[model samples]
Target: MKIASLLLFFVLGAVALPAAAQSVAEQQDAIVIENLRSAGSDITKPHSIDFFLYFPRKGQAKAAATEILELGYTVVELEKSPERSEWSVHATRTLVPELETMKASTRELEKLATEHGGAYDGWGTSIVK
Candidate 1:
């Protein structure tokens, strides 16, 4: 699963391709279907989204984000926390928590963060695009 996700991400995000291989309507339908699946039993609303990861660092956010981007991820936003002590970098591109390097506690991300003077804070989301 990790390999598949990684391959897909690199293929799609490593280069500047069209917005999506599928048409806009198809993408919207895909998002809606995934939302429905998540709801399971209720009339769930749909929202567009993607893979999400968080890195915390006061100064290293942009550097860390650049690295992830090199790996084919998309950095969405970066903001200093309410206390202004830590920075939060939100990113996406693919969902592959199973990667030995990306899995929590593996330290790959945390290590990367540290190199850039930060720490891998966390990860989030299930994405379809």
Candidate 2:
């Protein structure tokens, strides 16, 4: 009877989770797609950027990405190597915040990276084509 109850609870929890998770994911994707479309409207715009950082140890890369996102950057993606010593954070701005807003945020990100034994490698894009 104990095993039966436990199995029932697990089945119910599992059945309820996917729908919830998928809806949440779908909403986020819709928002992100809208932001991306708006941001990339200008051909000369350089908002799409990859911000790189290097940490002293494992797990710091994820921390770095979180901090950047907290600073109000539209984080597109985060890539970490197998060693987990580095992170490449992709950010694109859909709406203009204010003059010097990004500059200030970047300085803050740099400081945060330094605190984590990493360095902010600035922002750049590889190819326009």
- Give lDDT per model, in order: 0.53, 0.57
**How high is each candidate's TM-score?**
0.45, 0.45
Across 13-116, the per-residue lDDT of candidate 1 in tens digits comes to: 95645435433433344454445457552323222224323445545777777786786667788777665457777666443333232332224455666677
The true-versus-predicted C-alpha distance at residue 121 of model 2, in Å, is 0.3
> Can you write out model 2's per-residue Cα lDDT over 1-129, one digit (the tens) per residue?
999999999999999886575433233434443455565544244545455566655567677767777876666766665565466555554433222443554566678777777776654433332
Clash count in backbone of candidate 2: 0
| Candidate that would win on lDDT | 2
